[model samples]
Target: MEFRNTLEFAQEMDTKDPLVNYRDEFVFPKVKGKEVIYFTGNSLGLQPKRAKAFVDDIMTDWAELGVEGHFYADKPWWDYHERLIPPLAKVVGAKPGEVTVMNTLSVNLHLLMVSFYTPKSNRFKIICEEKAFPSDQYMLQSQVRFHGFNPEEAIVEVKKRDGEHFWRTKDFLSKINEVGDELALVLIGGVNYYNGQVMDMETITKSAKSVGANVGWDLAHAVGNVELKLHDWNADFAAWCSYKYMNSGPGNASGVFIHEKHLDKKDVPRFEGWWGTKKEERFLMKPHFEPMPNADAWQISNPPVLSMAPYLASLELFEEVGMPALLKKQKSLTSYLEFILNEIDKEVDSSFEIITPKERGCQLSVFLHGQGRALFNYLMEHGVIVDWREPNVIRLAPAPFYCSFEDMYRFGQILREGILHNE
Candidate 1:
């Protein structure tokens, strides 16, 4: 598809977009009396307009039903988390029984690691990407130490070669080989948070499996942003937060994936709770824990109804629009954004370089060389809301649900002006 760096072209694309009506479903942020061009959905998505009503209904149920809400409410708090499985499964490309809503992303990762990260004898090392999200780094380090292994000796990091912004697939595979028989687990982000590179999880998982190791993913950025096939990819487990791409409220309930093969393995150790007990016997108050048959076995407690209401509202939108349609618009929006950014750099004699791979979803991480916080500050003051990473990168994600082509053009225009002003 040909792209033009002009407002008219942007408007024309927006006019033809089938998903244009979706913009109306979300509430945009205002800056200085006008709606800003929000490009931070990769970090935190805009709230859906129906979010309030969704939460209000849950509130009303609690008010009228009180403790009885667990059984009699419209959504039945006892099984409210089940309502999310169908659509959420579609989002991550998993079997309905393979998916479940649970605790936060890191907590879910730790719980899954308990079952998948078991270290035996010589094979006790873990392989992960370098400079992972801080929480992941801390989690892996602690997990290794908990097993009585030095983090420096047990954690093998796959790093980018000099002058490279993203890890090459071959290098990642080579690291898996380097770790060899000592590799007990291979855990990586499905889509890297810093450079927005989408890893080929299927190939990596197969490679890791061939070498007799377990594989998993942190899909926090990939869940709703990119197309995934966790079950098909044969990933042993995966976890992701809902707030970023799914547009659930901040710190909302997260989704987890446990391959069907692992679900029925009762001996595959986990930290259990009452909610994980088989439903029929859950209230029996037995001394021993009898786990559920699917991903629900990982649940530590009943889901937070108020926090999950917004997710249900967003999932309804996902069901209506679907990932196929959403990803289609995302391709065009991201391509147009890339084209506009390239033209802006040429027009302004700027030094910004996009580090994100072409295979990425909505995000483009731009390395703003020579220009620093001043350029970022200028754009924010002028109503372009993008995220700034420390040092020199600005991350922009034009979410397909609400971001329009015109917003992309507006961002390019503002960026050009900001660059020149800072210069």
Candidate 2:
């Protein structure tokens, strides 16, 4: 893992990479007729080459079968969501019966919170990380208000110590202890959206359970990026979006995971829909709600197949590549990226600090201290597709499915020129 900051080294690594051919399966965006160095897969992954055909199949089925497509189409719209369970389970480390593809991320979060976040007289406070994704912060605020509790009193934020960008495991565990018997639920993003720190979900889950509190994770940035063991970790529930690392289309379907222990709990409260009813009893149009005995019990509506087609198409690649292989490339490629950027910082005398921890996925959140947003703009204008957080952070992710080591080298080259131009 001795990374060299040279184009020859990067290209040689690329040539030897067993998964390098995966780059061909995606269609990258172009700027001025050349392919851009795409590093935003942590935000929205590039479209898979097969996505179009997947959508076409859905379109053709709709055209030919109309309403009957639910039962007669090649994929059978009635059961299309089930097609994703195997791969999706593998991605999140859950049993197929413990996972379901449905709803958007926020909506699923709300649904799960409804079932798991109930607060009573003594155990009424919820613990979460400071600076969680904006949506999560908003959701927690509203949920607290909906339950007739003051947000200040009911929501406890576990913040990093002064001047630190990431939360240590002890910091979070201490917060869990501080909350004590008042803690009702512990919810957090598995991988932080801004700093790209992969939280220790196992220890968090066990700690929360020990304190008689429910726990869940929003895996939005972690789903296809890091190794997750939601089932073994005993996370009560979890949810994630597909568009980012999963490489589904924009605003695609999201996935949910519920522990098997919760599956047979008929007494659990949830906002149910017909799709969540037992499939056998569904056709009878029973007035009473009879929930499915698995994670599908959380489904509030039938899935949108067109939106899910690209996700299904993308999951095939995950099935083929497997997470272990992808994670190996992720660690190596991102480490190389970190090394190159550090080398560039030294060469240009610029203060580029990587805020993400070594236990990260493919992303490196570079804190550009002096160079500022001008460098981000310059990189974009020159065809390097990376994400810019407000203030001074640039997020670069080398996705294992499509990003190559050479792309990392090209990015370093562009970034070097950008720093020099700014100077």
Model 2 lDDT per residue over 1-423, tens place: 688888899999999999999899999999999999998998899999999999999899899999999999999998899999999999999999999999899999999999999999888999999988999999999999999999999999998989888899998899889889999999999999998999989998999999999999999999999999999999999999999999998988989999999996679999999999998888898899888989998897888999999999999999999999999999898888888898888888888889998769888998999878899899999999989998899999889888888888888888999999988
TM agreement with the true structure for every prediction: 0.99, 0.99
For model 2, name the residue pairs that clash.
none
Candidate 2 segments whose C-alpha is farther than 4 A from its true place: none
Model 1, residue 127: C-alpha shift (Å): 0.5
Look at candidate 1 and give me any clashing residue pairs.
Answer: none
- Candidates in order have lDDT scores of 0.93, 0.92
Global Cα lDDT for candidate 2: 0.92
Encode model 1's per-residue lDDT on 49-148: one tens digit a residue. Answer: 9999989998999999899999999889989989999999999999999999988999999999999999987999999998999999999999999999
Number of clashes found in candidate 1: 0
